[model samples]
Target: PPATARPAPAPAARLAGIWQQLAAQNTEIADLTAIKNHFERVLAGRTWGDPVLLHGDLTLRNVLVQADGGVAVLDTDLALTGPAAYDLGFLDASLDFIDRWQVLSRGRLYDDAGLGLARMALRDGYDAGGAADDVALCRALRLLQRAAELGEHVQRTRPALARVLIPRLIHPYFLAAAARALGVG
Candidate 1:
């Protein structure tokens, strides 16, 4: 049987479960909450064009380079219909997360100029029209979402002390990055 595409959650609704998990963990990320509120306020009563098919979990890990120089996307289980910006934003945030993680874990920094060029190329390649702000907001949201997911993963898999410590150490960087994406201080 062919898989059916489900409608993705609305922007505000997308982060609801993450917020619940954060609350359960007693994580107080005020900046993340601010980003969410700002996203809701800005997108309220606004239309983001018609929803389109999305690679709901698009990221570097899900892509592969073929021998013929083409690319393949794996893990289509999360495929759905949503605003096109969602996928782009998710990819952007994923790259940012990787860059930050590398710096934190290995003390190595990727080329900021190259990353900037790549981001610019990505935006130019996509016909985003007037939705630049939408992309930015979605990027911020994805950062927060990724951070919460990391915390959850740590909680489930790591030792008790790590469960308490890793999230505390890692989440602030993600929150700050999200804040920067949203133009917050």
Candidate 2:
């Protein structure tokens, strides 16, 4: 836990504004409100352990392996204090996004078995204790947050003609994956 890490809002609260922006841009994604509500309810019922310093953005790109078999983390700009599960879930969701993004953008297919093994290793290596459900919940929330951010980005950067394609294609994918992570449909 680093002193530089800031405190973050609750997951549902963090998603609310982004969700509003995304839903405003694409009406099709409005149907995701139900899923969002479900996330709010689930999170409302859970008890997140004491806040701890977190890297905030824990993606593969931010991690380094040292020659002496040590590990290092980079990019503390998004560091925040929250449940330990947040970092674990953020890393898991990031890996999942990278795998799917490759398939969507480059038509490259990766082995699911390898990804599964990596996820298992992540879970095994972390001492999450009894917060396994919290981890899954955070993962689902992060996926939805990523989707909302992408939608907002596309709306801002893409041309009117091209703006709809990326969000339409990937938003639902993220939503479905998020649902699965939440143990829903």
Question: For each candidate, what is the lDDT?
Answer: 0.70, 0.68
Off by over 4 Å in 1: 1-3, 64-72, 99-133
For 1-185, candidate 2 gives per-residue lDDT tens digits of 55666787887677686578667656465437667778777767667776776778887667654434345679878878877788788877877663457424554443455445545555654554333447777788788777777766777777574355645676877888888888775
Instruction: For candidate 2, report its TM-score.
Output: 0.75
- Lowest summed lDDT across 10 adjacent residues in model 2 is found at 102-111
In the range 71-165, model 1's lDDT, one tens digit per residue, is 45689989987777887788787776644564245544444554455455545534553334477778888887877777777778875865556
The 10 consecutive residues of candidate 1 with the worst lDDT sum are 124-133
| Residue 155, model 2, lDDT | 70
Clashing pairs in 1: none
Residue 89, candidate 1: C-alpha displacement in angstroms: 0.2
What TM-score goes with each of the models?
0.73, 0.75
* Each model's Cα RMSD: 4.6, 4.1
Alpha-carbon RMSD, candidate 1 = 4.6
